[model samples]
Target: MSKANRTLKKIKHQGGRIVPHLILITYMVIALFPILLILINSFKNRASIFNSPFSLPNAETFSLVGFETVFGRADFERYFLNSSIVTLASLLFTLLIGAAAAYALTEYKFKGSTFLSIYMAIGIMIPIRLGTVGILQLMVRFGLVNQLLSLILVYVAMNLPMTIFILSNFFQQVPVELKSAARLDGASEYQIFGLVIPLVRPALGAIGIFTMIPIWNDLWFPLILAPGTKTATITLGVQQFLGQFVSDWNAVLASLTMAMVPILILYLFFSKQMVRSITAGAIK
Candidate 1:
């Protein structure tokens, strides 16, 4: 509490910020700088791009050729929508089924509970791509190939493990007394899920994110299961666009920049919820 001691402590804290700030600033540059480069270059002419790839857009260099070509060649807005629909539907189905299964695993004690839980965990480490040949044939048998529904179904199955793992851990942290009391008050299991699940929504927000990123970013399943130009997700569409216009620097950069926009917007919007939800029940 002495004045000299307080001054020393403040100095130490001030010095501590330097390393962390340096690290943060370094990483931010590494992450954002490239995207910024692509975005600015997208607005620049072919000659200006080589002249100053990193320079700010100005009257001398700015152009919209990339944007023009991208818009002209493909239905980017539709591709964006396809990504959204598949991501959203897969997220919904994964969380619903995963949460329900997690609740059952955590809330009920039974003979094969441990075995069943272990069985579900097996999917986590396994890459479903290994089964592509069989999956393709099976889809053909069901006439589901080339459909967005096929992609949605595969994504749900793919993301189920982590979702169940997350929700189950959170469910276990919900006090046993709460569930018993809800039951005594005549709440059915479905009623309990309806009433109680909302309380865990911050956790769900975290789990929803964990499920969403892969589905949204995925290229393999979309390539294999639903490669139709009509139903292509943004990732695949952008890939196809880039391949077709490989020589068009402006269009290529534009497509990359366009693809980055929705994800960046989403991360900015839900970031706090995502972090909090993941760490919500850690101490308990």
Candidate 2:
């Protein structure tokens, strides 16, 4: 090849690599900007927060009054515990049942299997909030109103459709020979399903993060079915700081900042798997 042609090709290759990284960096900055703003202002006094919302906290403006108020006026510990319980429980059941259902629909050729899959997919298209009235009534009939279990059940149901949809695609991609080998080794159906779970860990991580975020951040279901102070999730608990006429900006920001901690931790924990999934999809 001519030197000029080779040089042009090298530049194109380098540009292809550099462009994606630059775009990713830009996207991250855009996404994190609001969270950063909230964190900075959460440490500032209320007046300073309003006066300089985007500025970093300085010695003059910095105060822990917001944090203090958040902890003082609310059962922060209980709210955190309730949210943890509901979110984790919902994720656990959603992944387990969704994985099982996906495996069956993909591996087994049973009657009505196609219809069942379609029925579940329909949930993904329709917003769960549209059935709020019916769900609330069902909760009331079951005497599960104002209970954490209600939130768990509702979240699991809400997330299951998408979970099944994603996991089904991944499960279908599992090599048939692997399952046949497991069978030859006398692995029961349950054992074979268990064996496939690790192979799809990336998909699980992606779905877990996607599913947990909505549940953790949800306020509508909690408000309708489990609004009791003892059962309030962090999102619902944060509402105490928001008043019609006199809102505590400092406390509200502080509470929001604190509420972000769990989601951030989970994202960090599952980030590797998510990256692997995304990279694999890109390669394919």
Candidate 3:
């Protein structure tokens, strides 16, 4: 109403905005600083790494020796391929199986459905690593102890509980009428699932992004279950490389930078969908 009041309100609103922006910038710096430091040092020589670690790579300090050393010592291509296979396979089975389990539990009234849901959900609370001894023994018995398939199976099992929990909530929000209408028109359960699965692509994508990270970054299972050079994921490969080349600063930093870049690119591409779907799923 008055100029003074309007000015005061504008100042208050601007002040409110400043606090959040400052907090966000602080968090961004906290998160990205290590990655930036790694990238910068990855380009510099060992002497520069210690003396000018904060400075950007310059003509005098810049080098690719680390990358060269990395390529020389490790079969990164094989490691990448192994990681890609395990991650993608685990993602595919986890989503499909989790979706089906979620659908059955939420849409059906069969006996023990509640108990089964609780049983599956128990995995979410318990870390899968706790059962590593039993898992390793079982895999050995099945002759899958040192194979990529073991990693895929273990990752899928580890991720499935959270996947089912997220999807079951989203499935509950899908109108019952949609399924009824499809059934009335002669669609079978399989067809209904086929149609419904696509409809929840956003939510699935969100969960996929969430599920894929830990699997990709996991070093424990890969180290224990599939530590062979041919079976090592990128994370395990990097760790092993670092162990042998601990004195090689450039290679160590380069290896870390390489490992971080792919995931960063992936998150940037899918982040919008992931955030939107997560919010929508939560609201539903």
- The candidate that wins on TM-score is 3
TM-scores of all candidate predictions against the true structure: 0.89, 0.82, 0.91
lDDT of 2 by residue, 129-154 (tens): 99999999999999999999988988
- Best model number under lDDT: 3
Q: Name the lDDT of candidate 3.
A: 0.91
Residue 166 local lDDT, model 2: 86
lDDT (tens digit, per residue) of candidate 1 on 1-284? 99999999999999897889999999999988888888888888888888888788899888898889999999898898999999999889988898899989998899999999999998889988898898899899999988899998898888888788777877877877887899999999998887768867877777788778888889998999899988999999998989999988888988888888879998999888877765664644
Per-residue CA lDDT of model 3 for 165-198, tens digit only, reads: 9888878878889999999999999898887888
RMSD, one per candidate, in order: 3.0, 4.2, 2.4
- Cα-based lDDT for every prediction: 0.87, 0.88, 0.91
Q: Model 2: C-alpha RMSD to truth?
A: 4.2
Model 1 global lDDT (CA atoms, 0 to 1): 0.87
Any runs in candidate 1 off by more than 4 Å, and if so which?
1-20, 281-284
